[model samples]
Target: MQNFESLNLFAPLEKALRELNYQTPTPIQAKAIPPAIEGMDILGCASTGTGKTAAFAIPILDFLGNEKPRTRAYHPTVLILAPTRELVIQIADSFGDYGKHMKFRQTLVYGGIRQDSQVKSLKHGTDVLIATPGRLMDLMEQGKVKFDDIQIFVLDEADRMLDMGFLPALRKIVAKLPEDRQSMFFSATLSPTIRELAATFLFNPISVTVPSKALTADGVKQSVRYVQRDEKVNALHSYLSSDKVDRTIVFTRTKHGANNLVKKLERQGIVALAIHGNKSQGARQRALDAFRDNKIKTLVATDVAARGIDIEGVTHVVNFDMPVEPESYVHRVGRTGRAGAKGIAISYCTSAETKELKAIEKLIGFDLRVENPKFKFGESAPAAKGGKSASGKSQGSRRKNKSYKPHWQMKGRNKRRSKTASA
Candidate 1:
């Protein structure tokens, strides 16, 4: 469908769409909504930020609206499973936005917080239940939730579920879902393993595939800066110092790395926060709120922690650590350049990370331009092929300068660098 109006959604949904200024349907939405509204199972392949939330949410809302659900405690008519708490929350927000004019009760269930409120919310009756796998499993084991009344089952970020080792939990959850319910499976990639898993859940499903380019939005300008392992923090600080950067998310490979990076940035006088599995839900939420409100312009996060975060006005994404998984590179960069807005993705790579960089390049089908830092921090050394530095200095000169200390190490350097490090 060219527009949401052509989809023939419920009256309230159409009204909500108009108010939200959602005119044209995204590729996944255009292909998935019609069949979904017709009660057919959908197997959709699309990346984050492609409006897939609306693709499945709208049809589910339409179904709930058309057929007034018989509310029952612990029985949700729609069960949407996402890989992370942020994504579950994001999906719930989308549902609320799209179904604002329609009356529906939805509850979010996730771990890292007391379950008292979530349990009470479930007992009070809800039309939709959005949750992460681990918490949902706990609730199921405790007999606080049920799948008997589920009319629609949605498994979003299916590939991520596998990456996080949620297959066993997924199978158990799917077993509880009624066979009569309509199912929808969405993932960034439709690999053989994902397809095999989807076959078990969906019957003769309609497959909707968004083009591969959608995974890496066209508006993002991607580049890499080769820095020594010890100088990564300084290199990142320099980039954050640039006036071009606004709201940014810096991805790290480990939770400890994320925390350390935040501390380093703070030492540089750049107020930043870290989010990872180690953080309490309250802490993560607070960090996210600060970022969304621009109270803090930068957030350092691990790959899993930052998954499913859909925020606007993110002008740049920095990779503080190269991700071992190429798929994660796509996810990290996808955080920016959303909603047709321009974005920049910069990665810091050391000599040891060249293998990971090559893997990422092979996956993206292109090479990232090696950007020379304005103030070199020992990244000018020649690679295997050998080349001169950006300053026309010989490889030998670049080597001789490797021991050269930058402003970060000088007696009065940090104080001076702090002035230029404000992000």
Candidate 2:
């Protein structure tokens, strides 16, 4: 167990850690902070809530201390690239908390909104710049920005960098950065591309792994339920109605499904909200705000909208529709069990979705605790009750649907290549 005082972090960082009641270093933080301060590039593998942000942020802030004079445009001495706008905002907020007492200024630039505010912030000369690939590249091409002066480059969510189809963008952005600068990358999963990036960017960097190989948060208790496709809603309704549920996030397959689930839950007297790509950013923010503030007991979201939601006290995550891609299951359940709190992830699987369940199990390298809820209408056989059946034989097996909407999916097709060039 490493303590904050022994780490020899700068006063402001140590003070913030103390204020945040961080007396002991998490496994990742314990291994990450020291070497990073010594000007070594780092490759850290850790889950979402295992204090990864602090592990990198504290070290980067210390490295970027108030030595350089302020510039007119936010020159971004420390560059942190994130996959999504929500993640960019969250990282910037964490930076603000730890770097407040220091004389450092940080700015967050991402898509999903107008660029006026971001451009204005850039003109004011920020010391640290946290941004997404698309928006940052756009700003650069518009002749409003450049990464020529960045001394430190941090790539957060390396798995997502490849997952969200941002590998090319990341390569382009990294190409523009000074090759001599320090480089670091953090992610829950280390794909081959990530390893290749480490070789291409870092110089003999110490590799750090916390609770090493675990894809999802250790604090999250994962389980699954076998149900018919039509009965997924029924199972979810039952789970929410139980006295055990406090706060929950329900993930659906599509935007329409998310909204429909919310409406279904609301009709059953369960207070719920939905967030998706089709909704206006204001509406999405409002729903997130309500969920975070405890005004909404449950939030249903599509995969895209679920990426950047950093809410605490999320008691459980319900996968109403299973994700075909195995990695997505890890990210979906990661919403809970954050900030060191225990949480639960319950996935609903149908007969047709069995392959996906098996794929997820293979990816995680563990079998989920499977539960078959005893339904109230258990004995009604379609053929026994005179209802027409395709197979005609009436047994305990109930028919189910096979197809689901994975409007988008992770293309984890081939192994990431080594010896990366300017793609």
Winner by TM-score: 1
Residue-level lDDT of model 1, residues 114-189, one tens digit each, is 9999999999999999999999999999999999999899999999999889999999999999999899999988
Per-residue alpha-carbon lDDT of candidate 2 for residues 160-219, written as tens digits (9 for 90 to 100):
777778888888888889888888888777777788877876788889986533537678
Q: What number of clashing residue pairs does each candidate have, in the order they appear? A: 0, 3
Pairs in clash, predicted candidate 2? 73-125, 74-125, 74-126
What would the TM-scores of all predictions be?
A: 0.87, 0.83
State the displacement of the C-alpha of residue 349, model 1, in Å, after optimal TM-score superposition: 1.0
**Which residue runs does candidate 2 get wrong by more than 4 Å?**
72-74, 212-221, 363-365, 373-423
* Runs of candidate 1 exceeding 4 Å displacement: 373-423
Local distance difference test, each candidate:
0.88, 0.78
